[model samples]
Each structure stands twice: as structure tokens, then as C-alpha cells.
Target: MIPSNILNIFTNTEPSDISYKEECLTCQIMGSATCLVAGAYFMSNLPFLGSNTSVKRNPIWWKNSVKGAGAIIFALGILRGGEGWLWNQEKYLTNESK
Candidate 1:
């Protein structure tokens, strides 16, 4: 079984000090953009950091692993950014309408 401390890192049982709604729009955009850019970079497999001789010798499995990571990051970016932007727009629109 996983230890409480280790599981805590994986699970967000406690509330965050700063709620998502309180986060600034700029921060949210930057966070999402960073994730998306990083994901794309990884997916591209441009040998950004692995241009070394030893890295070049890596097998196909390693490349596949990187791509998988990229896909996850890209999805995370979409979810995080989409939720924030959509929610804010909804809130603003509701307030304006009333």
C-alpha cells in the first residue's frame, strides 16, 4: 500500500490556499501556454536536449515514452486553460446580462 505522504503528493486531499477562481487571467494563460508549448516540443522530438552522442543511441521505446508524456501534457494544458477561460467568460457574461 502507498504511504500517506506519498499518496498525498498524488492526491489533492487538502484545499489549495489560492483557489483557481482567484488566479489571475494572465497567470492562467501563461500556465496553459507553457504546458502546451512544452508538450508540443516534446512531441516534436527535436533532440532539444538529447542531441548528445549517448542520447542519440537511445532505442525506439524511449522516443515513444516521450511522445506519450507530450500527449498527457498537451491534454492537461487544454483542460486547465479551457476551464479557467470558459468559467471566467461565463461569470462575466452572467454579471453583465443581469
Candidate 2:
């Protein structure tokens, strides 16, 4: 059986208990890092885009488009990573809880 702790990382909803907060934080950080790396990779021209004849026809336009997409991904990673600190009950609890 998959452990609740492990499962929680993949799920979007937080558990009622705060015990898994650390795991959630770690998951977010890792996800952020992965996104950032992927963004960087996409932004870079290191990967050969020449495989497709169409891409070869307009390399500059394709590179710019890819870079723009990478920038958006990088921004999303930054936002996701920054939310790690807001998981506490005091900050995250709804108004109904107050």
C-alpha cells in the first residue's frame, strides 16, 4: 500500500494534521527546482532543434518562442517555490477557522 505521507506529496489537498508539512515543503522545493531546470534547458539552444526541417527554416523565431515559454515556466517555478512558507495553519487556515 502506498503510504499516506507519500501519497500526500502527489495530492493537492493538505492533510488535517500538520505532521506532513515538511514533506509538502520538500516536494514543492523539488518541483520548483525541476521546473527551473527544465526552463533553463528550454531556454538554451544546446539541444539540437535541427532534426525538423521546418524548425531549421526559421531557427531564430523558434528559439525566441522557446525562450519565451521557458521564461514563463521559470516564473511559475519561482512563484511555486515562494509558497513553501505559507503552509502553516496560521497563514493557510480559512477565515472560518478564525
Candidate 3:
């Protein structure tokens, strides 16, 4: 689980009248989605693009970049999942009370 401080870096919440500093959740979701999709696409097509040849070594930077991007995307997805779970719980509790 991401620490509250780190999560705060990714999302701001309004408590009473106080607005906390945080990254836009929507932007996080979009960024993660884009990175994951793009990384997957590039990785899948790399072999077919003659990048598999021993003489023409695939760039190490490219591999690392894709992996790193994918990891960020995966982390964001986990955070979003937590958010969604809390959202659903709130909705459920609200409905139950009514």
C-alpha cells in the first residue's frame, strides 16, 4: 500500500473547507493507461521489427524505459483500485442506510 503522504502526492482531497495538495487522479489514470498500452504495443512489435537480431542489439534504454513505464502504470492501477473499492463501499453503505 502506498503511504498516505505518497498518495497525497497523487491525489488531493477536500476536507471541510481545506483543500490538500495532490495530483489529479484522472490524470494519473490516463497516464497509466497510456503508458501501459503504449509499452505493450512497443514490446509486442519489437521482435517483429528485426530488433531480435544479435548483431543489431535492441537498445537497453528502450527495454528499461518500457519496463519502468509499465511498472508505473501497474502501480497507478493498484492505487485506482483502492480508490474504486472505497468509492463502492461508500455507495453501498449509503444505500444500505436508506
Rank order (by lDDT, best first)? 1, 2, 3
Q: For candidate 1, which ten residues in a row score worst on lDDT?
A: 16-25
Q: What is the C-alpha lDDT profile of model 1 across 59-98, one tens digit per residue?
A: 6788789888998999888877986356557765554554
Give the residue spans of candidate 2 off by over 4 A: 1-23, 49-58, 84-98
Model 3, residue 86: distance off in Å is: 5.2
lDDT of 2: 0.71
- lDDT winner between 1 and 2, please give it: 1
- Tens-digit lDDT track for model 2 on 1-98? 75567665778585576553343567888989988998888888755456556765667777788888998899878877876364444554443244
Residue 76 shift from truth in candidate 1, angstroms: 0.7
Residues 1-98 of candidate 3: C-alpha lDDT, one tens digit per residue: 75457677568675554343344557657765765565566545553476656534757777666666666666555555455345546754554555
Which of the predicted structures, 1 or 3, would earn the higher lDDT when compared with the native? 1
Q: Stretches of candidate 3 above 4 Å error?
A: 1-50, 54-57, 86-98
Any runs in candidate 1 off by more than 4 Å, and if so which?
1-21, 48-56, 85-98
Q: Model 3, residue 63: displacement in angstroms?
A: 0.6
